[model samples]
Target: MTAEIGPPKSANPEIVRRYARLLREHGDAFNVTDNQTAIVRMSSFASALICLQEGAEPIMQMTCRDRNRIALQSDLLGASALGVRNVLCLSGDHQTFGNQREAKNVYDIDSTQELQMFKMMRDERRILGDDELEEGPKMFLGAVENPFADPFEFRVARLAKKVSAGADFVQTQAVFDMERFERWMSAARDRGLDRKVHIIAGVVPLKSLGAANYMKKKVPGMIVPDHIIERMRKATDAKSEGIRICVEQIEHLMTIKGVHGVHIMAVNWEEKVPEIVEKANLHPRPPP
Candidate 1:
């Protein structure tokens, strides 16, 4: 799972401890986001290093929103030096969506370029600009895909681009509607993209109906089915109901043709991660 530092992304002592709990108790490794939502906080490299010191593996993120090609390659090498063996490349959310609406969002290289850059650095032993590295970063590279994203029919094709560009694995956005997700997965399988990338399905546990409504309405590239909202509304305990819903999603995800595992996004309800992981039978994670 790609665990958040915070919404804006932080690297405080408390946030580090929370990360430790998630990694040591409930998950295999945690993802360190790169200025999520474009609101500045600690660097993903720093957060990942912190996770490493705490005995947790980190998936370092490098988004095209903040760095140019030079900075991107440099930061990736730095991450490798700090023992971050996994990297997730992404095109960040627009700056207009963040608290700092006026900040310039640099997409000098879109997400696909980010993936290709990481691959070139790792596999070719050279940066995208053709500078050679003595010893390239031997890292497991990843990319993000949101099956719930618009033009859903083209989402699988985009996944194909990621794989062809050298993404070793992929973690999709929070998947609430298994039906739609399966449809996406089917197309991915049909094109053989699933065979090429480790597909980690993302899941978010709905803490309350308010959260559900917010995701349904506010979140872009998200698809939260109305039945889930109705279930949350009728629940005697919304929290417990959320857990059950997450578990249900996990089970359904496991049955899909090419899903390798699940990435549980606990969000604000991070403390409840252990519960969802345990109840969903994801824990006692296999030793690395």
Candidate 2:
């Protein structure tokens, strides 16, 4: 029989501990952010606390855009110490999308390098040069993919590289165009990547007309159909309609074969996750 894999752990330490306890008690998957802005703003920590409180396993995302090598290593160390066993490393969103325009951008290490660093820490129990008495964090490293990005070939190549770099799993960008996403997944599988990594589809719920428009105009590669937009416009309450649309979209994606799981980008709409899970019938897999 195939071994059953639980949901990825959250990167936030506090959430890690909470989810660790949850998995120990009741098993449920809780998701969290990897964006620097969210981390700095303490939303990452806050969500981690929620995961712990609810006894839910969390999948934490870590990005390279906010911290230098030293800071990044420090955070990783802290997370491991706090029992954070899963990490989704990312290069992070560009500075322009964030609040601090004047702040310096730190790309000291990209996601692939970060994954390699995590692998080294797990295998060596210490950084490459520093041989110290440290218990390395055992992290399930994950990466992100933007199937809609230009030069589709390049995106696939980068994904293969990330898997080679040490990524155990991958979560894709918000998937609006299912056909395009399926094509990318097919190509990835043909490249021998599908067998190596567990791919979780990313789903973000549209909150308002403005939100839809911003994603379409500002967030490159996120394409929402005109029909979805029209539905949002016709709804009596935009927020309610947005949630309904999210549920519908998630349900549709869940039916597609080859998708391991759905990573919902609630974006502060945490309360709605349980609803989506129920609507999609996503239950915790039995432990092996």
Candidate 3:
């Protein structure tokens, strides 16, 4: 399984290194967030470099929200120079939701276009302007998909678009509604999208009932089932209950045909990752 970790709000390499070392014990890769929620933080590139320094494989996330094509390309080239090999492309959260509302958004290209650009840079050794590169970034491309989103039937088609644009792997939005996630997976398999790319299911280990409620009500593309909330509500130890639920989700995801792996997004509860990984029988990951 993989684990997604966010950088500190300000500059703090030690914190990033600590998380990287802790998570690397059980996860195959560490996915560093790129100004997630559109809120400013340490750059994903720097955090990913910290992961690398901590002896972990870093899946650096890139968003099209803050930078134009030229700037994005420059960052990718920098990543190449730094030896970071994995990247997750995203359209990112809107600027209005972030602290910098006055900041002009630069979505010169959407996520799919970003993927195409990165893929071209890697495969064809070229940039957006078709300029030849002495050595293009050799990256394993990834994209995000929210199966819980509305117009559910079109989610798989959306994933297909990313695959066609050259996403090597796909990490889904956190899975709380198993029924819907399974249905989406089934559809992806039906269209043979699963065959084209590795699908890593996302799971969040809730810390309390309040977190569950918040996710259910506030998160735009998330769907937290009432049953899960009720379970959390009745649990005497909410944190442990959340871990149990996350482990169960990981186990269940393994049974799904198209799921290649699980992405544990423990958020602030990063220390519990090893416990959850062991409980889910994903510990001592196979050697690369």
Candidate number of the best lDDT: 3
lDDT of 2 by residue, 1-288 (tens): 001112223444553453345333222344456544422454443454455455555556667887777777777777766666677788887776666777788999898888887777877776746675357877788888899888887888989999988888888888777788888888887887878888778787778888877777777767777777788788889888887887777777666656676777666454455556655555444653
Q: Indicate whether candidate 1 or candidate 3 has the larger lDDT.
A: 3
Candidates sorted by lDDT, descending order? 3, 1, 2
Clashing pairs in 2: 9-58, 10-58, 10-59, 10-60, 11-60, 18-52, 34-61
lDDT of 2: 0.68
**Which regions of candidate 2 fall more than 4 Å away from where they truly are?**
1-27, 34-40, 43-50, 130-134, 284-288
lDDT of 1 at 166: 88
- When 1 and 2 are scored with lDDT, the better candidate is 1
List candidate 3 segments past 4 Å from native: none
Model 1 alpha-carbon drift over 4 Å, by segment? 1-11
Whole-model Cα lDDT of every candidate shown, in order? 0.84, 0.68, 0.93
* Whole-model lDDT, model 3: 0.93
Error of 2 at 122 (Å): 1.1
- TM-score, per-candidate, Cα-based: 0.96, 0.81, 0.98
Worst 10 residues of 3 by lDDT: 279-288
